[model samples]
Target: MDKENYTAWDSAEFLTDDDIIIEYLKAALEENDPAFFMKAIGNVARSKGMSTIAQETHLGRPSLYKALSGERDPRIGTVMKVLAALGIQLTIAPRQA
Candidate 1:
């Protein structure tokens, strides 16, 4: 494939809408891997504006970027803070047998 023939896409661009972001997060949660959440949250942070999210969560921008990076695991508290900042609340649903 020719490099010029392909266009690059960023996941964050697809998360421009609130409903889409929520759905994306739900899908990520369903993946059942801890790293997926970090990657999803990182994509969200990028979509929502890292500086804004950082300010809302009272976390440093650079640290937030580092924590949400897929290679590292962020604390549950940090994840909660990010979710809260994004106006998302986690709810438990009983698994179907």
Candidate 2:
């Protein structure tokens, strides 16, 4: 099945554990630390399936693997591409700390 064919259930009528988890990860990525951002995204990619996510971002599976595996730091454009593909939005706000 194509990953793009799958839709995230944000609706109250059909929320799944995965949906909640994804939301948490998305929220956590809002932290000030870049490491937190990377880890959150990596975790989500693993749960969502790397190959499917790669296809969604139009990035190659090998490239996604390298980025998420921490072997390399993805460029800002790459990070934005993956986040957008995963339906994650990053927002800036005042630091809680």
Candidate 3:
């Protein structure tokens, strides 16, 4: 099935609070769930505007889809590039209980 055929809610609801979204994303990273990470990336991309992100990262739309959707394993640098393109700043925090 095409990814575009699904809505954001299909995987997770759209997180309205940016801070909460970031925190949830941080926790997901800590858990190391590739699917969760991909979902977070997709949510961020959807919230931030995929086309604009693609343009800013100098990546084609299909490339963005593959990377963010986990169809391909992108390098850490590439993931950072995409996050930067989406105007999101990543920060590390001590593991939480």
Give one digit per residue, the lDDT tens place, for model 2 in 1-97: 6556666753322323666766766566667566666766766776667788888889998888778654567798888888787776667878677
Q: What is the lDDT of residue 86 in candidate 2?
A: 72
TM-score of each: 0.89, 0.64, 0.70
lDDT of 3 by residue, 4-95 (tens): 66444442355666776687677777778876686678767767777888898898878787778855677787788888876677777786
By lDDT, the better pick of 2 and 3 is 3
- Best-fitting candidate, measured by TM-score? 1
lDDT scores in order:
0.91, 0.70, 0.74
C-alpha RMSD by candidate, in order: 1.8, 10.2, 5.8
The alpha-carbon lDDT assigned to residue 50 of candidate 2 equals 74
Which regions of candidate 1 are displaced past 4 Å? Answer: 1-5
Which candidate should be chosen as best, given lDDT against the real structure?
1
RMSD of 1: 1.8
Ranking by lDDT: 1, 3, 2
* Residue 70, candidate 2: C-alpha displacement in angstroms: 3.0
Q: What is the RMSD, in Å, between candidate 2 and the native fold over all Cα? A: 10.2
